[model samples]
Target chain A: MSRVIQIAGLRYRYPDGTQALDGIDFHLNSGESVALFGANGSGKTTFVLHLNGLLRGEGSIEICGMRLADGTLEQIRSKVGVVFQDSDEQLFMPTVLEDVAFGPLNLGLSPDDALTRARTVLKRVGMAHAFERAPYHLSAGEKKRVAIAGVLAMDPEILVLDEPTTFLDPPTRRDLLSLLRSLPQAKVVVTHDANLARALTSRAVFFDQGRITGQGDVIEIIQRFHWEYS
Target chain B: MHHLVIDRWSRGSSSLHQRDPRAKLAALLVFLVVLSTTRPGAQWAFVAYAVLLILTANLARLPILGLASRAALVLPFSATFALLTWWSGDSLRALALAEKSFLSGTAALLLVGTTPLTGWTAALESWRVPRMLILVIQFVYRYLFVIAEQVQRMRWAALCRGPKQRGFRLAAGLVGVLFARSWQRADGIYHAMLARGFRGRFVPAPPAPFRSSDALFLSTCLAGCLAIRMLL
Candidate 1:
C-alpha cells in the first residue's frame, strides 16, 4: 500500500521548554482512516499540526512522498486539510459560500472556479441552502459541515479532523459521520470518543506522554485502553 | 445578539441594498464631508441632512426607529463634547455637535445596513485600503457574534451562581477570561487559516463589475447631497 503520510523522529518543544511531542514515528496508508486516541495534551494536536507543517519541529515528514520543508509547506498544506475542533474558528468568512471558497481561492484557483467548487462541495455537505448565510447565524452542526466543506473545497488528499463532533448533537454526529465516510480521502481523526473512532476509523493509535503506546484494530485498542466512560 | 438584527437587515433586497458597495461607500463619504463642513447654526442644512438620511433609511426598508436607536449609541460620546460646548456658551455649535454626530452615525449605519460586511470591505479593498486593516475589520466583524455569545453565556453562568448585584467583580473576572479565550480563539483561527493554504492574505472573491448603474446611483446621491448642502 502506498503511504500517504510518513513521519520519523518527530519532536516538538514549546517556547516554555515543555516537550509536546517526543521522538514519534507514524505512517498513514492511502485511503486508510486512523483514529488518534489520547488524553488532552498528549501531543495529538501538536502531531497533527506537523502533518501540514503548521507547527514545525525536529521531524522528517513526507506527504505523498514529497519531503516537507519550508519550500514545500504550501504544497503540503493543500494536500492535508485540517478541520479544527471549533467550527467558529474554521468558518471565519462573512458568508458560508465565501468561507468554503476560502481554501480553494487560497490554492490559486480563479475566483469563478473557486466559487463553483465551493458551491459544489457545499452541496455535497448539504449546506447549499446556507450559501449566503452569515456563518455566525448557523447552528453548531451546520457550522461544522461548512468547515468540512471549506477543507474539502481544497480537494485535499488527506483530512485531519480535530474533534469534528465537539458541539454536535447525536443526530448531527451521525450525519457528520456519514458525510465523512462518504469522502474518499485518508483521514486522521483526533478524538476521545471510542465509539466514534470505532465507527469511523479502521485502526487506532493511542498516545501517552507524547509517545504512541499501541496501534491495532479500533475495537481492540478501545477495549485495551478502556477509552469509553460508563 | 442585537447586532444580528443589522446583519439581517443588510441581507434585504431594497434598491439601496442592491446598489454596489463602492457606490454606497462613495455616497457615504460625500454625505460625511458635506455634513461635517456645514456652518455652525446652519440648522436648515442639518435638517436637510437628517431628512435625507431618514429618506434613505426608508428606501433601504430598515425600521426607522430601530436605526435611529442604534445610531443613538454614538450620542453618549458626542453628548459629552456637546455638553462642554454648551457650558462654554456655544449652544448652537453644541446642538450641531450632537446633531452632526447623530446624523453621521445614522449615515454610517445606512451604509452597513444596505451592504453586507464582505461587500463593503471588498469595496474598501478596491479603494486600496490596507489589506491588513481590511483583514482586521473582517475578523472583528465575523467574531463579534462569537465573542458576544461567549459573554452572554458567561453572564448566565455568573447569574446562576450568585446575586446579580455582585456583577462588578464577576464582570472583571469575565473580562480577563474573555481576553484569554479570545487570544486562544484567534490562534485557532490563524492555524485553521494556515492549514487551508492561507499565506498571509485573504483571496478576495472576484468583485462584481462596477456598472454605470452604480455610478449613476453615486451621482444621484452626490448631486442630491450637494444640492442640499448648497441650495438648502
Candidate 2:
C-alpha cells in the first residue's frame, strides 16, 4: 500500500521557547486509519499542524509524495483535510451551503460547480436539509457534519480529524462515528475517546512530552498509556 | 438578538426584499443625502421622510413598530448632541438633529432588513470597497452570534456564584476574558482557513446579475426622495 503521509525528525518550538514537538516520526498508508493519543500540550495538534504546513518546524514531511514546502503548500493543503476540534472555527461562512462550498471555491471550482459539490457532500453527511441554515443555529452534531462536508467538498485524499466528537451527546457521537467510518479516505484521528479509537482505527500512536513514545495495536497503545477514564 | 431579528426579516419573500441589494444600497444613499440637507426648521420635510420610511417598510412586509423600536437604539447617542444644541438656544437644530438621526437609523435598518449579509456585502464588493475592509465586516458579522453566546454563558457562570456579585469590576473582568477568548478563537479560525487551502484572500461567489427592473427600482426611489426634499 502506498503511504499518504511520511514524517521524519519533526521538531517544533513556540515563539515563547516552549518545545511543542520533538523528533517525531509518523506514517499513514493509503486507506488506513490511526489514532493519535496524547495529553494536552503533548504536541499531538502541533504535529498534525505540520502535515498541512499550518505550523512550520524543522522537519521532513511528505503529503501524497509531495514535500511540504512553500511551492507545494497549497497542493498539500488540498490533500490533507483537517477537521478542527471546534466546529465553530471550521464553519465560518454565512450559510451551511456556503460554508461547505468554501473549500471547493478555494480550490478554484466555479460557483455553480462548488454549490453542486457542496450539496452532494452535505447529503453524504446527512445535512442536506440545512443548506440555508446558519452555522450558529445548528446543534453540535449538525455543525460537525457541516464541517466535515466543508472539508469533503474539497475532495481531499487524507483526513485529519482533531477531537471530532467533542461537545456531542452520546447519540450524536454515535452518528458522527458512523458517518466518519463510512468515508473512504485514510484518516488520522486525534481523540481521547478510546472506544472511538478502537472502532475507527486499527493502529494507534501515543505521545508524551512532545515525542511519540509508542505505536502498535489500538488496544495496546491505549493500555500502555492508560488513556481512558473508566 | 438584534441581528437575529433582522436576519429573519431579510429571509422573508417580499417585493422590496426581492429588489437587488445594489438598488437598495443606492436608494439608501439618496435618502441619507436628502434627509441630511433638509432645512433644520422644515418640520414638514422630517414628517415626509418618516412617511417615506414607513411606506418602504410596509412595502417590504416588515413590522414597522419592531423596526422603529430597534432603530430608536441610536437615539440616546444622538440625544447627547441634541441636548447640547438645545442648551445653546438652537432648539430648531436640536429637533432636527434628533429627527435626522432617527430617520437615518430607520432607513439603514430598512436596507439591512430586506437584504441578506451576502447580498449587501457582495454589493459592497462590487462597488470596489477595499477587500480587507469587506473581509473584516464579513468576519465580524459572522462571529457576532458566537461572541454573544459566549458572553451569555460567561454571564451565567458568574451569576451562579451569587446574584449580588455583579459590579463594575466583574464587568471589566468579563470584558477582558472575552477579549482574550476572542483572540484565541480568531487564531483557531485562521488556522482552519489555512488548513483548507485558504491563500490569504477570499474568493467571492459569482455575482448576481443586476436586472433592468432593479435599475427602475433605484431610479424611482431616488426620484421620490428628491421630490420629497424639493417640494415638501
Residues B1-232 of candidate 1: C-alpha lDDT, one tens digit per residue: 5678888999999999999999999999999999998888988888888888889999899999999999999999999999999999999999999999999999999999989888999999999999899988988988987898899998888778876547577679899999999999999988998988888877766778988989998998999899988886
Clashes counted in candidate 2 amount to: 0
lDDT of 2 by residue, A93-191 (tens): 888998898888889898899999999999999998998887887999999999999999889999999989989999999999999999999999999
lDDT of 2 by residue, B69-162 (tens): 9999999998999999999999999999999999999999999999988889889989999978887887898899899999999999999999
In TM-score terms, candidate 1 sits at 0.91
The per-prediction i-RMS, to one decimal, reads 1.0, 1.0
